[model samples]
Every structure is written in structure tokens, then in C-alpha cells.
Target: MTTENPVHLTPELVENPVGAYAGLRTRPGLGHVVLPGLNAPVRLVTRHEDVKAALAEPRLVRDRSTIPDSEMPDPQAELMAQGADGLPPEYAQYLSGHLALFDGDEHTRRRNPLTRAFTARRVAALRPFVEKTARELIEALAEREQADLLGEFAYPLSTAVICALLGVDAADQDKVCGWIRDFAYGDGSRVLEGLGGVVQYTKDLVTRRRAEPADDLVSALLADGGMADDEIVTVFFLLINTGITPPALFLAHAVLALLDHPDQLERLRAEPELLGRAVPELLRYVTLVRMGATLYATEDFVFAGTGLRKGEAVTVALFAADHDPAAYDAPERLDVAREFGRGDGHLAFGHGPHYCIGAALGRLVTGVVFEELLVRRPAAPELAVDRADVRFGHWPGDGFHLLSLPVRL
Candidate 1:
């Protein structure tokens, strides 16, 4: 067993947390624990079974209206999946349109267009561009003998793809990237502080897109996304700022998992097709974005033999649910070869009507990027970097961090 006290908080877990989690899972489930020194009653759902049941059960909600914003909801699950502590009006408005934050048919509507645009076929069409981009980036890194994959490659790659989908200019890419960075790297306070700048940028872009329409989603939205400037500004704010935040962090986590599992890496290279199935598993393995938006129970519901309070906070313990052994056999094991054959499912992208809309986009990016990494740099050098050096935003369940790898060329 690891010697580090579970009560002690460290940046290491925020970077590569599988070990810490494995230890945590072994502890007794019914104990009430404080987050470091915080005075909040938190129920840690470490076992695979408990996490799974909690996620599927409707009694566990996400909306902040159900829980007091100032009070942290069990620090064990950090990084507010909804909108951090305290839902500000502008931020709330921004989140209302983002498909991940919304529920019901409304989310379906905003998602439909993008969904159609990113079918398996569409993602396949993107392979060539992805390969080309990855190849060039790797070549540059190999030449330099070192690279910050998160900042240098992953961030630009994902952001560029999102922009292309929205019809934003490459010139606007850096400015747009700033919002996601602040959200990903900055704490809860910084997120609110940086919101105004992101909103202004999105609003300006919308104004331009409205006056001079283009063949992008923004134009289509102006013509069809079914929202005016005010509404468009809100969605745009979420798209750049909020939506990109968690994903950026999690993608880094997935990459770290691959780096740690060399055998799995080789297996992936042998059969690239496994990527489709493996993406979900990888999402589960890291449980990086520990939870989804805290949902508020609209009506009375009973689950797991527990009576839930109405308007009580219902949260999908995403990390818990994804890692739950009930859904995955030997949940802790990173088995790339496991067929999983078939099963219930994972909470990586959430569940029910509120499922993640950008899920396809994220999977597409991660999978394609993985394939490209193998193809571009087939050298397969082992990473030589300390876990502590790879730090991330200090939040419970935070993912990724400063991953600086020194591998043999």
C-alpha cells in the first residue's frame, strides 16, 4: 500500500492519479472524510459498483440550484463539473446553451447540426488533415528534442478543429485559445474574472459573422442555430471558455495513461481499429473529469434504496461511475486487449438525455491524435519525467498538468 496519507492533497494526483485512486478505492467506503482541512461532509464513492449505481441513479443531481454554491460539494470530487462554486449570471447564461450543460430537447437541437457534421464518416474524412497536422508537429518536436504536448500540440490541434467547425479564422485561434487556457489552468476565481474577456470576444465574432456571413456553423446558427446575438454570445462563450476547459484537462490525462501503459500502447499500434472501443475505456480509466454537472432532481425519485430530497443536488460521480467494477471487469486493470465483449456502459460522456453532445468531437480528436502519434514518431521512446513536474490546476479530480517529456529520438 502507498504510504502517502490520503488526507494530504498534492499536485501529483491532479496529473497522473491512477495510483492515488487505486489506493483510495481500497479504503472503507462508509467513512466520512474531510477534504484536506475543509469542514464539509463528503461521501467518497471509490468502489466501482457504488460509482456506477450513483451515476445511473436519477437521485444524484448536477444543477447548482439544488446545492449551495459557496459550500463545496464533497471536496473528494473537485473541479465543479457544473460551473464551479457559485453560478454567476453571465456564466450561467453562457452554460445554458452549451449542449453539455443543457438538458432535454433543447440540448438535442443545439447538438443535432454538429452531430450531423461529425458522423463517423465525417470524422474519417478528417483523418488526412489530422495525420498531416500530427506528422508536422512531431517532426518539429523530434527536431527540438523536447516538447510540451499539451501546450504545443494538443491545445492547438483541438482548438483549430473546433474553430474550423465554427468557421472561425486561424488568426482568431490564439485569442480564442486564451479563454480555454484561463478556464483550464486558472482556479474558480480566475474563471469568473476571465469570463468577460471571452464573452466580449465571442460577441464581437458573432457581430462580424452576422453582418458578413460565412460557410461556418456561426453563419448557419445566424441562419439556423435558432438564437440571436444575445443568445449566440452565450453559446459562443460556453463553447470557447467552459466547454474546452474540462476536455483540455482530460485529454491530457488520457495521454498520460497511454504513456504509462507501454504494453497497451503497442497493442493499440498493432490494431488501430481498437481505438473506437478503447476511447471509452480510456475515458473511464482516467475518470479525469471526475463528475458531470450536478443535476437537480426535478421531481421526487428513489434510487439505491435511498430517498432523495427534492431539489437536492444530484451529481453523476463520473470518475466513480466510469471506474466502477460493476460496468468493467477488474476495473483498475488497463486492458487494451479486453473486448469488454459488451456491457451496460461508462459515465465518461454522461448518460440519459443530458449525454455529452461534443463527445463525438472529443473522441475523434483523441483517437485520431493517438493514431497520428504512433504513425509520426514510431521510435517509441520511454518518457523520462517526474509526475510532480507535470502539475495541473489545483482542484480535486483535476486532469493533465505540465507534462514535459524527455524521450530518446
Candidate 2:
């Protein structure tokens, strides 16, 4: 229950979390870990079964506001209760109102409108745009001798697509997305500053959209009139920021993963239709989100044979769960045709009500990226730098936050 023998996050752990968690996964009950972003040590859930269950457990809640003040843990809960860490007031104001931080009816109210945009038909309709954008980017990359795939292709394509959806001006897309990129993936010191810019930009964009409605998500949300101005601003901010990072990072990592496993890449290339399977497999293999959003226990309960106290924070090791040997035979191997396209059981997008809202978009963009880069191309791009030379950003709670993946076309 306590972190007396807590696993401290280290460079080694971030570099290879699956291997680091393997020992803990085989043991009974949950392990304890001191992750960087968390205010206190948390109960670490690693097994595939436990993680899947924990994700949907009603007693486990993402909105800390729902927990009673009396049950809140001392300094840990108090510190987190402060909310923004050290974010500027203007920035924190918008940041705090986002739908992801809410629970129950409030969460449902905020999520319902957005769900219309990500439906199967809607996502399918995006294929053409995704493919066209990818083709243009790939063609540009082909012209270059060597380029950082993340910066040149993945980031641009992701930013452009999300901006198009949100009606971000073509001229301002780069500036807006650059701030989000800096906030999400930058070195520690600049995060708050970068986030400040994003909030301010979103605030102005919201004002513009209100004055002159356009045919985009922002205008649509405004037209719905279900959410207040502040709520709409935060939602817009979330869409732009989340929309860009996950897909961009996933695309870069997918390319790297395939390049690393040539046999799997060849398999995918031969069976071009295997993308549906390949996407989830690569997601499971790479595990973009190293940890799921921290959930606080609403009541005292036993989970995974461990006695969890009310208000205790539970963090799921998503990367570990996806690679869990008990769940997947030959879990370490990257098989494009794994499970014959079932695409079930991976905690990459998580499970339950709070599952990633952008799951469909993430899949669509990354699938299109691979389609343009590998299946339809004459040949795949080659890593310009030694595979070992390429590095991921050392951000806690994020897996495979690729800094730059240099490749030659």
C-alpha cells in the first residue's frame, strides 16, 4: 500500500519501460512507483487484465474534484488541488475547464457534441484529405536529401489536419501548433510559457470564430450553444493540442518501428491491406502513452489483490500492459497480422468512457501516413542516422516521444 519500495522513474525506466516493468508484472498485486508529474507515489497497475478493469472501475475517477475534502490525502491531494502547478492565470483558466478533467454528467455533456465529429462515417470521410496531405508531405520529403521525419512530415501533417478541422487560419497554423508542440514536448523549463501562448491564442481564435462563424469545429461548437464560452475555448484548445501530438508522434514511431523490424515492414508492404491490424499492433508495441491519466479512488477497495484506500491515486502502466507476456503471445515481437485484425485488448487508446476521443483520427492519420510512405511508394525511406543515434524526449508519462527521426528518401 505504501511506497516503501517504490520504483523510482529513471532514464533507464523511460528508455525501456516494458523490460523495467516485466519483473513487477509477474508479481502479485500492484507495484508502487514515483512518477515525475504525480504529486505523490501511486499504486502502479501493470497487468493487462487489471489495467483494463481499472480503466472502467466506477470507484476510480479522473476528476479529483469528485473526491470529498475529508478523504483527500494530505500534501499530495492538497498540492494537486492547486490545479495549474505554476501556469499563468489566463492560461490556467482555459486549461482547467477542458472536458477531460471532468466526470459523470459533466463529462458526458461536454463529450457528446464532439462525438459527432469523430463517428465512423465522419472519420471515413477524412480519408481523402488525410491521403492527399500525406502524399504532398511525402513528395516533399522525397525531394529532400535528409529530414527529421517528426518535424518535416508528421508534425506538419498533423498540425495542418487538426487546424483544418478547427478552422485555424492557414497563416496562423504554424505559430499556433508550434506553441502546442513546445508545451507538450519541450524541455521542462519552457512548458508553462508555451502553454500560456496556446491559451492566449485560443482565446483570440474563439473571439474571431464567435464574430464570424466558419465551417469548422469551433463554429460548430459555438452554434450548438450547449457549452459556455470558456468551456468552448478549453475544448478547442484540447482538440488542437491533443489532435496534433498523438497522431504526429504515432506516425513517427510507426515509421521507426517498421524500420527497426524489417521483416514486419516487408510483411505489411506485401499485405498492404494489413494496415488495420498493423495500426493497433504498432500502437500496442510502441505504447504512445506510457501511463494513463491518474485516477483517484472514490472509496476504499481492494484492486489486483492490493488494498487501496479512498483518495489513493492509481496509475496504469499502459506501456507495460500492452507488452504483458500473459496477454500477448510473443508480446515483444511486432507482427502486422497479430490476432488477424481483431484489434482488441490493447490499452494504447485506453478502455471505457474516458478512452481517447481522438482514437479514430489517430488511426486514420497514421494509417494514411503508412499508406503513402510505404505501401504506395516505390521504396520506403531509410534512417539517415544510426537507429541508436535517434532519440526520444525524456518526458515522464509519455512513451516514444520522438525528438527527431532523421530519414532519407
Candidate 3:
């Protein structure tokens, strides 16, 4: 298992994730690598089949506390120590009660209600509003020759939609968005400050919703007798935060991918209905939520033909799996019309019980954004800056994130 040079996590690799993933796939099965910030050894599952199997295994657990101190990464250990305790219950849950960190019955109980809230029918109903929002945002850029698509279009559109869903007041949307960005992707030291701002805001929102319920999901969760105040706050925190970053990044990358492959972009423009197939393909190509999902071996077992001790941590490389040569015909090609079969499925949203709950909403928002942008624009938008000049930020536990995307219509 030892090598002269192990893969070291770095911003360079994050900037060009596809290349990094391709290299990792060359390993025997699972490759052992050290994450930079955490500075700890983790079993990196790269191949599509191996990543899928690991995700489906019931013996792997999400809770990091179960792992022995000797096995846990220092950063992870520090994070776990900060879990809900002295803080108010609502704030505690907001910090540590996300669905990604739960397992078994508790995970099931929390997820079911949220699942019902984001049904296909419900997401479809949001299409008109999403389209309207996209149109408005795009039209606002009419007076300018060039704009930062990420800030003016993607961020606002996502924030508006998620705020609408969570019953967040229009006046407070900017503040909430700021806090979420800092919490998820900002400086490490300021993360706690960002978390505090979000928790306090969510707690206040929950109280207001409880006193006077609305048609929004937050109100619905609060009214549910089975859910406690802290649980409701936690749900709100997860939904609001997750709702923004992934979709925003997806939009930015989708636009970048489409522009890079003009032939595919032309095909999409010629036949707009292909959005159904195109969105999934784009998701597969851009696997924005690259890392974050980790599983601990509940007991001693062999994974990917390698023996693993109990309580060892495994990080599933969704980006690597999505681009696995064994899974797709031309894994590196960005073909919007590429067809996917059951076994050759993409793991962009993950697999098994922990798959993204907001998958439908994400698709709707992204589809509507592209439909509106491509259909209504006088001409296709072009990158104002050279593609090579574009910059991205790499959050260690999270994935590569686009900081700014400048374009001209």
C-alpha cells in the first residue's frame, strides 16, 4: 500500500479535478491519499464500481465519533469536538445535525419528511417562478456588455429561490447568503462566526414561523408535531445552505462546459427539449459537490479487495467515479446527448440512502436557468476573460468552487 509519492491534496489538483480524478483511477482499486488541510490518511475510493459499492454498504457509518482517536484526522477531531453541547439546542443541531452526518433509523426518520416536501410535483410547480427569476436576472444584465454571471445571475437566482422556499425574508436574503458563503467556503477561522450568524438567524426565523405559519417548507416543518424546535432549525439550516452552493456551482460549470464545447452547445440550442437529457449529462460532467461524504468502517471488512480495520475512514471520490472510464463511453467528453444506463450511472448526487434530497429542485433551477439564458439571449454569451485565466477556490473538505465567472452577452 506504500508508495514513493502519495497523492497530496492541493489547489492545483482541485482546479483541474478531472485530470486528478483520471490519475487516481489508474490505481489498483482504492488508493490511499493524504488530504492537505486534514493532513490525514484516508482510503480514497476512485473507480466507479468501487465507489458505488462502498456507498451501498450498510456496514459503513457516517458518524466520525465512532472512529478511534488514533484513526481520526486532526481537523476532523477538532470539528467533532465543537458539536452541539454548551450552545442552545437549536444552534447545536444547526452545527452538527445535518442529514449527511446521521445514520440508520435516525437518518431515516429525519429524511422522510423532507423528502415529502421536495416531491417532483412540488419542484415542477416551482418552474414558473424559477423561469421568471432567471428571466428577471438575465434582463437586469441587459444594460451591461459584460457581467459576473456567478454574482449577478447564479448567486441571486439560487438565493431568491431557496429563500422563497425557506420563508426567509427578502430583506435578510443577502445577509443569509453572506453567512452561508463564509460558513461553507470562507476562511477557516471565521467559519464559527459564520455558523453563529446562520444559527441565530435560523432560530429567529423558526420562532416567527411557529407563531404564524406560512405555506413555506419551514412553516410546514415547524407545524409537524414530531419535529422539535432544534430539529426544525437544523432542517432549515441544511436546506438553506445546501440549496445554494451546489446549484450555483453547477450553473457556473454548466455554462463553462457548454461554452467550451460549442458543438454540443449548438446541439442544445437547436433542440431545447434536450434539456431533460442535457441537465443530467451536465451534472455528470461537472460533479460540483466533489467530496464531503465520508464513511467509517463499522467493523473489520475488506473493501475493493483491500483489508480495512474497523473505524477507518473512507472518502468517496464522486468526481473520480463520475469520470471513470469503466462507467462511460468517452468519460472525458462533455456530450450533452450521452445516454446513461443503470450500471453505468453517475454518482454526482451520490448513491443509496444519503443521495441529495434537493436533487429535483437543483435540476429544476439549473434547467430553467439555461433554458432562459440560451433561449432569450440576442446572441450566445462569451467569456469576457480567457478560459485559462479563470480562477477557482478549493475548500479542503468541500470541492473546487468557482469564485467568479465573467461573461459578455
Candidate 4:
């Protein structure tokens, strides 16, 4: 509460979030601060407990006009949603638009429609196909002696799963992957400025699916008729793209974590019982999406003695909150078997109604792939690319650019 200068979580800080979040939390004020180049002043919620409390608060809106733009990058989400610019108003109207950015009756209405798509029964049905794909990719990588798991493994794995669920052509997975890259690569400012014509692609795809329905989620939605075209675009944007980028990055980090902690890897390898717990541990340890997207204050509100002004933007940093000393004891230390949610919940996925809908599916895909990654090659290969040398065409959120690694294949 005492700091004068605003804290900006820039692209540079995202590269190594462990230190960045740690350093940001230790500043003079944890509640609020401001940045210069950004459009408006921001209030930064540094601690995990506070961020959790804020995510559930209705007063904190996602619209830019509700919150200051300087603190968080997503204000345009409101503008985009409102059709403030020439862009369609319903651009973010889908499940990816999901509950994360929505509120109350409308949020429920939208989510209720798509809830079944991600149910355990549905995802379980697709596991055989997912497993087959993972093994095939691994086998292909083994043949080459190197493959970037992000590009070659995690990216396609997540992409294919979602696309398949949506009933899109599995062969078009590469094109969807490219669109996913353009959407969240951090360079994108809006549907128009950043992802030029990206929305149009989603529209065209949905139109085609509607013209000729298929066995996918998109076809089902078209049959249901609750979703509008632009809304479909938004849903497609979120569903087909988001969520797994972090896991892709986390996959790379998990390997790094496991290699250094051979005992942990040995435990998982020796007994598969540890896979589920290990997944959370790896997420907790790697802690992707260092800074969660911004949220605006819809009206005047206060939390923990911090008086927040109306329309001021604030950040609920997921990484900083995840690693807060108060949230998790020795959070920096990675323990694969540690009981997550029992001790302290991790915010790798955002909290509350807006939580990542695909979280379970994402974890499922990542776990299956990770399990196969180790099984396919017992000795994790040395990444041909240096850890420091890797870079995503986009910034942190795209996941690390893990293009290739020299494995013991």
C-alpha cells in the first residue's frame, strides 16, 4: 500500500517468472501500483490469497472502461466484446470466452451449453485416440533423434484433442495451431490489431461446419442454435487455442524438473500411481502464465484495507499468488507427491466461475503425453537447444519455443 511507482509485468519478466513474481511480491506495496507506457494506472494484487478473493468478486470487471488499462492487458477484451471498434461485438462470445470473463446468468447460460463436451465420459472416449497420437508423435521424434515437444508434441496434442472434440478435420490441426499462435502470442492487442483476420477464419470454419454438420462440438453447437456466429468465433478462439499453451511450456519445464529431480522421475517411472499427483506438482513447480490477464474494477471496492478506485485496473498475478509463502509452504521447492488442494490450491488455472473449462482435459492430455514421453525414452534426451536460447515467436504465454531436443532415441 505504500509504493508510489506502478509495477509492470513486462515481456522481459515473463522469461523467468520464478524470480519475477518473487521480486514483484516483495515490493513496497502488494495491493496497488501504476505503470507509465501502459494506458492507465493499475493495482497489483501480489499475494495468492488476495488474488483468490478478487477472482470471486463481482465488482472486478473484465471490461477496460471498468478498470485501468495500464495495469492489465485485457481491457480491450471489453472493447472487443462491446464492439467498441469495428470488430464484432460477440467476437469473444464462446466457451473460451467461457466463464472466465463472464458473469451471473449469462455466464451460466453459455457454460451450461458446453459442459458436456468436457465431461469425464466424453474425454475418456477420446483417450485412445489421444494416446495413439502421442505415441505416434513420439515414435516420429525417436526416428529423428530430436523434436521440440512444444511444436512437435504438446502443441499438436492439445490442438488435435480440442479440434477433434469440436468435430473439425483432424488434418487441419496445423492450420488451427497457427491460428492459436497468432491469438495469444502476446503481440496480439485485439482481434483486429493483433490477430488480423483471425476472427474471420473462425467464422468461415464455423460457417462451413454449419453448412455441413459433423460429429464435433462445433456441429453439435450449430444444432443447438444457442450460439451466434461471432460467439462461436470467440468460443472457438478460446477452446481450440487457450489453456494448453501453459501446459506445453509446463511440459518442457516438467522434463527439466524431473531430470534434476531424478528420484521424482524414478518414483513415477517405477510406479504409475504418482502420475496424477505429479501433474499438479509439475504445474505448481513450473508455474506457467506468470501474470494472469488483467481485470477491471467495475465500481469502488476495497479488499484487505486496500481502497481501490472505480474503473482502476488491477492484476491478480497467478504465478505470484501460486508461489506466495502464505499460500504454499516452501512453494519454490517442487514435490511431485505433495498433496495439492489439500495443503494449498494452485492458481495455475484461474479461480472461480471463470476458471479454465478445459483444465481437466488439458491435464489429461499432458499426463498421457508425459507418461508416454518417459516410456518412449527412458533417458530424457538432452535438449539440443539451450534452455536460455529458446524463444516463442510470441512471448511467455505461448509456452517456451521447445523446437528440438537430442534424446537418447
Ranking by TM-score: 2, 3, 4, 1
Error of 3 at 321 (Å): 0.6
Question: Number of clashing pairs, model 1?
Answer: 15
Candidate 4 TM-score, C-alpha based: 0.79
Badly placed stretches (over 4 Å) of model 4 are 1-4, 8-29, 33-39, 65-99, 170-214, 342-344, 385-409
Q: Which candidate's TM-score is highest?
A: 2
Candidate lDDT scores, in order, read 0.58, 0.77, 0.76, 0.64
Backbone clashes in model 2, listed as residue pairs: none
TM-score of each: 0.74, 0.89, 0.89, 0.79
- State the lDDT of candidate 2 residue by residue for 1-409, as single tens digits: 3567677766457446457788778778887777754446778888888999998888888787678764544323544455457666766656666665677888899888777645677567668978888888888888888988998888888877887777778798778777766776555567876677777777788799899997777777777777777777778668765777777887888889899999999988899989888988898888877777788888889988998888888888888888888888888889999873344558888888888888887888878888889898888789999878998664444344788899997
lDDT of 1 by residue, 23-86 (tens): 6556654223333233333444445566556655544554444344334344423433333456
Sorted by lDDT, highest first, which candidate order results? 2, 3, 4, 1
Candidate 4 lDDT, 1-409, residue by residue in tens: 4345445545455434466667766664454434312434456776877888888888876645434444433433442344334544454344336445556677777776677545677777778988988888788877784666656676667766766776657676666656666554433454354344456666777889878887677776777777777666667666644655556666766776776788877777777778878888777667676556667767667764566666666667676777788877888777778786663258777787777777777678868876788744566555565656644442323223344333434
Q: Least lDDT summed over 10 consecutive residues: which range in candidate 4?
A: 393-402
* Candidate 1 residue runs with Cα over 4 Å from true position: 1-61, 64-92, 95-127, 178-197, 241-243, 298-301, 341-345, 387-389, 396-409
lDDT of 3 at 83: 39
Off by over 4 Å in 3: 3-5, 14-20, 67-75, 78-92, 170-197, 342-344, 397-399
